[model samples]
Target: MPVLVFIDQSEGQVKKASLEALTYGAKLAEQLGTHAEGVLLGKVTEDPSLLGKYGVKKIHHVDHDELTHLDSQVYTKVIAEVATSMGAKLIIFSNNADGKTIAPRLSVKLKAALVTGAIALPETGDGFMVRKNVFSGKAFANISLKTDIKIIALNPNAYKIVSGEGTAEVVSFAAQIESPKVKVTQTDKITGSVPLSEAERVVSAGRGLKGPENWGMIEELAEELNAALACSRPVADTNWRPHHEHVGQTGLAIAPNLYIAIGISGAIQHLAGVNRSKVIVVINKDAEAPFFKAADYGIVGDAFEIVPKLTAAIKNKKANG
Candidate 1:
């Protein structure tokens, strides 16, 4: 019984979430007393051998240009084939956009039991049961799998990406890869001050800033702290910021070590997205803002005054260093 992990990549590069999956699979393999391997669908820019540090004994790579772009239908068929050929009893996926589309399809095709948005490693004592977040991270659910094969799509940032002392050998498996039905016409990228999903600290804003012009204060503070800059849905919807910067139930959900919100009245929808942040700081003039309830710390004041003072304090601390 071996564990096979799907390494999600974009533009010839593996995603941060894939590393989390790799780490998770490696630990699972240890717990089960089995070997862990990763399958790279497309040609990744990074050296596949270096991934051995993550505990994948071999990397099954199908380096086709068509594989670079995601085609849910075609990719699912190929991956299911890989799992079957490799005799993978357990398949792991990252609960990112790619996993959201591929995991369900592969589950149906392989007739395997699957759990998405998994928050913790599976409990494999009696039956395979995994704990996951429900109700937008407000609740938890333990799903038990009852199939010969089990599939899990792990939620990003839920598990730590841990590595050990040794590197494993990388073996290349040859498979008949196929072209995807969907062609890559273009891709609009989101550039962040800090990688949002992987950032330890996040600074966010909303319509309370009034307009894009006032975003400088937020940026200045984030930059000073080397934190990711994020926004609420209204900011993204109104074009004050890009959609990628949106963090909420309808947008990108994050669980950073520290999340700072300034000038935004937190709506329940928005709260659902970022409620997982280890520490939440809400800065709103209205002390009664709903976000304050979820926040670990609250300050009732104007952001314009508070942000500059905070930025100056951080800058001063850095200068002294």
Candidate 2:
């Protein structure tokens, strides 16, 4: 049986997380001595065959208008049917908002063992065991899946995307599309900003900046770095920043390549969401701040003084080059 990967898309474009999932799935399939295939729902503007570079041999496309919008129940039902028909023993999904919503439901429908937040490939020496993050990125847990059919949700940015020269054969899958229960009446899209979830670099701040008026420096730093802007939960609750910019245990989780924190206290709740960042740089005047302990590099100085200098240095380097 071939490994089947769920390719998640937004606005007819494949998500970065899904590319990571495809690479992971393709590697896993190679390990299992089987080929990797992808399943895409909805109409996409990009060529499905281009995903072959990520290692999938084929793509099963369900080109339906209803699938443009995510309906967890409908997605689960259709995917379960496809898996059953294709006899896919292993299924992979990107552990994002859509994957989180659909994977569990598909697991229940297919009666398969489901593992979420998988950070690494499975160890198949003895049995199928997958390593996943537990306790909000604080710890690792190895889960053993005994079922014949297994489902794994790869954490976003957990695996590197490997692409090579190839073209996948795209095939049309005739799935029974159903109407979505949830209706999206309006979409408030934030334009001209890097999406926090998919951002490679991020510059974030907290109440230490004092108020919304002080946000100009943070924005300037982020703009210079070409990174996303984020804030702590309190800043959002106080209405200093929009709630969507808030990142913590109760808010959106992110794992960027570079995370720069300014004036944030680094509470445990806040760390849970961003601790997976590869490199963390914390800037604060308070040397006793807890965030410094978790930071890869700590600057014990005022962000107001440090940020401008750092931004200027970056500008100078870019200008000279």
Best by TM-score: 2
- Compute each candidate's TM-score over C-alphas: 0.94, 0.97
What's each prediction's clash count? 0, 0
Which candidate number has the best lDDT?
Answer: 2
Give each model's whole-structure lDDT: 0.89, 0.93
The residue ranges of model 2 lying beyond 4 angstroms of the native Cα positions read: none
Q: Which 10-residue span in candidate 1 carries the lowest summed lDDT? A: 165-174
Give the per-residue Cα lDDT of candidate 1 at 93. 97
lDDT at position 294, candidate 1 = 93
Cα deviation at 72, candidate 2, in Å, is 1.3
Which tens-of-lDDT digit does each residue in 196-238 have in candidate 1?
8778899999888999999988988999999999999989999
